[model samples]
Target: MKEGIYYDCINDFLNKNRDIETKKLLLVAEYTNFELKKLESYSGEIIGAVVPFIVYNNEFFNKGIISCDLEEENNFLLIENLKEFSIEDSFFKKSKSLVVLVDGLSSYISDFLDNLFQNIPENTQVIGGGAGKMTFERDPVIFTKNQFCKDSAIIISLNKKLNLGIQNGWEYLEGPFLTTNSEKNILKTLNFKNAFEVYKQVVEKDSGKKFTDDNFFDIAKSYPLGIIKYDKEVIVRDPIFVDSDNNMVLVGDIPQNSTINILKGKEDNLIKSSGIATKKAMEQIDLNNENYCVVVFDCISRAIFLGDRFVEELEEMKKNINPSKNLFGALTLGEIANNGDEYITFYNKTCVTGILC
Candidate 1:
């Protein structure tokens, strides 16, 4: 694998890695600095980039990068048409593989993965995040080597071994309310009551705090919804906004009839869980022989709730993983991972670590 890092914008990526011969490139950029619309008209072999809060060497920075492979170009496949991906495709036959995804639309990611996992081999490991800004604009830019796009996603297949671990420190606060009514990412009701009313009541009761329109986000940041999964795995769903009708809009989708619990967390627990997640991920792979990089897709909500203490979470990750190894990733709106047992899932307010070798 060949990698190049640049302090400049997306336009400078090719210049920095001119000598690297690669068929597919995985780009990670600072969300604030990247322009998504500029690459829409670009005409080149498919290459794509994601916008997230980037991490490197235990510090957060806004640097852009292009990671590519020269010799493994044949093993790499750039998938644009999610509907067209199939098991019979030569790309799925590889022995050990990793899929890096940069999705322009978070809503479509679940659907895309549903189709993707059905065709890919069981040994394949997937990692990536929803690429966009907090603005929640209609056109979030995902870029290619020479083009930018909206409402599209880039899927890169690489022949490599990856060990993944997922963890969320948020503790369950209330009942396993059945999702009585929901539409895509909007929660209309919980246990047949107005979603916001139930949420507000539960939070106020638990925290002894009042909820106002002005302070909703401040109060809601520490309290998110957890979707129960098999083997006691809970996928978190963050409530981003409350609609006029008091319906709660979430960062990711919550399926109807599914049981969910309200979750709450503290700074100490959140920070402590980061170390546990890192340690578990590192334990999955043999570090002595392989060249590995620890890639983390941590929820941005955690950082917001943690404030200055967020740095302590990063420090925990660094300490748990081999201190000499490279640690880098993005603070994402939503994180994606599949730990072999569960289906590949999209989660909010969670930490996902991938030890890629």
Candidate 2:
């Protein structure tokens, strides 16, 4: 794979790469300050976020583009409906190994991912994220070389080897509380009481912090809900908004009847965990004289919670991986990683690192 970064303008990147030949191209465009239409091109699919900055080749660019070239034609797949979609046998006939990148609506992430993993081959490795915003105003926009889409998703398939690592540095605060009532991504009640009331009460008690509608996100971001899995693996759900009825809306899904816990994290530990996650990912891949790029899917909530110290977290990840390796990705509303596990989970307030060679 070959990677290039352009910072002057999207036009510069598009004009220069018009003649390049490759099996597949992945574009990570940052739209923090500019509009998405400005970067629209007539070449490859673009999957990314309206993040504050972009990370490419272990460096930062406020508004830039990172493009990569792969060497296989049938290696890319773009799907709309996970359940109805089927991979052509011929696509994977040449190479069974695959890397999947997902950019979907925050509210429908869990349902999309659940159906996605069920239909894909068992050996397929996946790593991607919920591509949208925390604002909840306009739905996140995804584009494909020509048109922009909303409330939809894009799936990219690559025939490269990848090593994935997922980690959320949150510790349990309370509850094996049952999700008694819920809709897709909204928690109506927990253990027979209003979900927000239970959450607010526990957070106020644990941190001695008061909860008000105005400051709910500021206080709640440090504390997210964890869906308990086997061997104590918890899939985190970040509560983004609370309704008038105090029903909490999470970034990912919380199915009815599932047991959950409120989790807490300190800045120091969260930063440390990034390094550990990078190390864990490195352990899964063979790094012997091969060129690889590290793609990160980090939760935007972590940036809000860490404030200026978020730079330290990124630095920690760089420290763990080889200094010469390239790093690039977006700060997503939620992260996705299957890593050959029993389930492909959609997570919030976590960091997922993928070593692709």
Candidate 3:
């Protein structure tokens, strides 16, 4: 109904540098099979908000290159075929510094985003989120074409320098535990027994109630996965489903060879992270009086966990950011961010990762 906020950065890119129009602009939204079409539709809304601003501020870049890929389905994608159309290729070009906007769905984003630095330019930067869902099978309102069903994605790419960062406030809990057995992305065994059983052990040994099928939703909301990143930072990846066989837990992506940690989130934590992320990003540029456009990707789980607490998180952005700037994003399963040098960092269960140009 209302224009999203990301248009602020898109519009700024058009105005700041007179030469931006000469470069190629590509927009991509890498989402899961569940939200592909809906994300595409959101892209349409983004285009609607951005187009007029582009026309008004910087139409000189007569040639605008735009393409949207609903990233390949997890179980169905061929790694080789997926490699050919990389997330890096979506934005990086020779001598071109791109402005990338991303919205990740599920842990499958990691598979699609592995080896990000191989193709992206050194000057490239992005901002976006790990958006969540209304329901497993129902699509959000942004996409209405697929009977509001799940299984769709969206991506948008621009050519510019917009300071970007993703902020998630999941603190590490006990047990940087090991996976004794596994499948591809599914954990077949953690020491031994059903995956849920292993989690129950963690709860019993630690602080929480035992998880049962009737109370799966309770644990699902509070306990999430933490993947260790290159910087020794633990990235949160949400656990969506569990496979009873082989003791495997079907997470968005595998927690990898390292020990897995439990992560916890609170309303204050989400709001604080949002502020910290935005503040950290502002510090990157001329903070004193500079203007920036902000966009965000939030975990759907936070919405569920906070319920009444949710208002504070979103409200803080309005209070902290420059309101005129356009901002728009969805709740996703995972999030993608880069280390600020090269390579896209594929994270699970994190909050906002975005670019401010």
Candidate 4:
């Protein structure tokens, strides 16, 4: 592995540890809605340098995964062949790790993930899941400027010594325990009611807030969903969408047959959870040496809830992580982490922090 941070306009930061040319890099960036062209233009340069597996965007304007090559020469083929390319086809063989970028409508992510990991190598590590949807476009190298166009994702594969660790903590409320009647990645029903409705009921009853599409965030953002693991151990994930029809709310995938409970959160608790996540990641690694990178998948709800105080958590992570290491991450619709078992767990309403050294 090569050592040192390579920062550029197109490449925000790259920590190469070894002289591995065939580096497996997993890169992800989220941009505002409908800005795929601008986002892709810059991402094209980033992945072109590292040879990414596939780039993804979560703007679920349609029904399938859009596919394309990084090079302009294959632009026509990539878009035209998108339907033919399953999410698996975008990932080539010899992939050592994965880099991902996401923003825009995050609802489609779970749909992509259920299929994406099917053929991935068992040992592969994930590197990126950076913040937000960008609407405006800037140079591939420069990351300044904000535009809300479309949500997108980019993935890269790396080959070399790589490590990743994730930590998250969610407070589970005693009430709001509900059964999952039907589900998919972004859509689900709880107690035969739409996710939004159930949420409305809870908030109106407790907080006296009305549930409406416009006021969904007033009650729904960072809402927690509890899951029953195989051993009956419980974990919570957050919901990302509220489908009006079928009375089901859309969320990242919740394994079938798992019991779900809706949990509530406060701003202070969310920040504390971030600290806990950082500590957990640190606990996973040796921590005897300087780290290379730390990627955070904080729920956007946390950011919206915390506002200015959010940077405190970032600084805390920077201090806890060796100052020599680089840290970057995004507020995502859903976060994925390994639970020290065969499964790479997906979470919502929790800070999913991953450190790579």
Candidate 5:
């Protein structure tokens, strides 16, 4: 496997690597600030998404494109409609890992992943992310070399299994609140009261910070909603903003009638959890085999919450891995990974890593 990061543009990178060896190329790049065009006479397939930032080695950046060449037998599928994606059973049978990238701004992902996880076998590991710009404006994020798309998802089936590490360090701040009136990703009413109003009452009292229109995301990142699932599991969901109806729009979906907790994070705990996640992945890696690739789907909200100390979170992950191996990933709008022997789902404000050997 080979990869490189370009700061200026992808056109120059495509021009430079026209003689690339593999047929599978992934272009994980920063949002639509760069110009793009199809390579004339190019025969290779390209798949990737636009993200807020790209993670490479020990550092992260906002203005760059990271292109990689896949080394295994892989199949790429583009789901223009997440609710109705189709594939034969042989597709998962032939794949050892599934890299799923979906539109971050869409509310259909939770249901989409639920159906997808049921179709795949236990031996198959899954990882990927929600693709969108930081500005939260609707635009094309997931794509092929020629197809710039929206309201879509791209599934890349790779023939290599993965060692996975997944963790989120958030403790309850309030809530045992009931999601009474919710639809898709919109939290309309919690416990039959206005969702945003209930959230504001708790968060303001806890942090002594008012939720202004401008600083909603900045404050909400530290205080997310946690939905309780079966087997003592809790999934985190980020409330990005409030809509005109005072509905809290979350990054991931929560069905109505679910129990939720308002979660809060400490800087130390969040950073340490990221390190623990990497350590778990490292533990699963074969010691004798020095060759492996690290791909992460970390939540973009974590970066905003950590602010200048976000480097500490990156350094924690870097500290556990072998310095010789490349640590590559994206600051996704949400994370995708399968839970231990349970099922796969979309997550918010968490870190999911895959060790491809």
Candidate 6:
């Protein structure tokens, strides 16, 4: 295991670590640190992506680079064309688990996830997240040692299975509305009516605040939409804006005919949920490998809505997992994970924790 540390300057890191080609480099950098000048100057297999922020040792940083070494090389896959995402059948033949990262703004990401899970070997779990900025500007966010890509995804297949936990503590506040019209990430209608109209009726009455065009997100962040799966946990989605047609534009896709409810969150319950997710991951740690690494895909919206209190979310996580497990995480535009025995999908407003051996 190579040392995973933060470097403030890309040139400083590139100059000091010039000999890093011997090992597979996993580089997670802030959007400011991303530059692909002279890829030939460096060597070896590299997995790099520009994210909103990276979390190491439970500390949050909006800038700098997080570099470490990864396990296997041949199994790593980079899907540059997300709209027509496809992989050979032989790719996952030797994998036990997967770490996935996709561009958050990609329209075809949901389809990609659906296809990836349906075709992959059974019992192979997936974790990781959507990479991008809070502004929703799309670019070459996903990268490898040689190629920088956008509207893309990168996957690292593992020989070791990861123990996982996924949770977002937003309590239900309203009814089982139907998504009457939807395509990709847009929620066009709810319960056969304008999506924002129905949402405003519920949210305004509950929060005692009116929704203006400018303050829609400021008011809507506290009230997200939740979709319920049969016997599994409820998955949450964040509605970021209301279009002129009153459609609810969300972070991820909300399939038509899906049953959804408006959910409300508090500062305390959200913080507690992090600890619950961490403990759930820790409980499944293999007895043979008592020590495991921690990886989290936490939603960037959670940090924005919580503001300074976001520290409590990380603090709660630190209390549950062992002090020895090295924690690596990112504040993603949208989260990607699947709790065991459930469907793999893109998510929002949730914390995804994985314990890797």
lDDT of each: 0.71, 0.71, 0.46, 0.45, 0.82, 0.80
Worst 10 residues of 5 by lDDT: 1-10
RMSD of each candidate relative to the true structure: 3.3, 2.8, 9.8, 8.9, 1.8, 2.1
For TM-score, the strongest prediction is 5
Off by over 4 Å in 2: 1-8, 21-53, 57-62, 81-106
The clash numbers for all candidates, in the given order, read 3, 0, 45, 54, 0, 0
Deviating ranges (above 4 Å) for candidate 4? 1-44, 48-96, 102-108, 127-153, 160-165, 174-180, 186-188, 193-195, 231-237, 240-248, 255-257, 286-288, 339-341
> What lDDT tens digits, residue by residue, belong to model 1 across residues 212-249?
87778788998999999767788899888787888998
- Tens-digit lDDT track for model 5 on 1-357? 333344446666667777764655454556435544654445576777888888887678787677767655677778888766776677777777888889998878887887777777776788888999888988888877677888889887887767889999999999799999999999999989999999999999999999887889878888999999876678999999999888999998889999999999998999999999999988997899876778878898998898899889998898898887777878999999985456788889999878887
Task: Score candidate 2 by TM-score against the native.
Answer: 0.88
| Candidate number of the best lDDT | 5
Residue 125 Cα positional deviation in candidate 1, in Å, after optimal superposition: 1.8
lDDT of 6 by residue, 167-275 (tens): 8888989988999999888998888998888999999999999988699888988999998877756878899887777788888888899999999998889989988
TM-scores of the models, in the order given:
0.87, 0.88, 0.66, 0.65, 0.94, 0.93
Please give the ranking of all candidate structures by TM-score, highest first, separated by commas: 5, 6, 2, 1, 3, 4
Q: How many backbone clashes does candidate 4 have?
A: 54
lDDT of 5: 0.82
Candidate 3, lDDT over the whole model: 0.46
Name the better of 2 and 6 by lDDT: 6
Candidate 5 clash total? 0
Our tally of clashes for model 3 stands at 45
Flag clash pairs in model 1. 39-148, 40-148, 47-144
Error of 2 at 155 (Å): 1.7
User: What is candidate 3's TM-score against the reference?
Assistant: 0.66
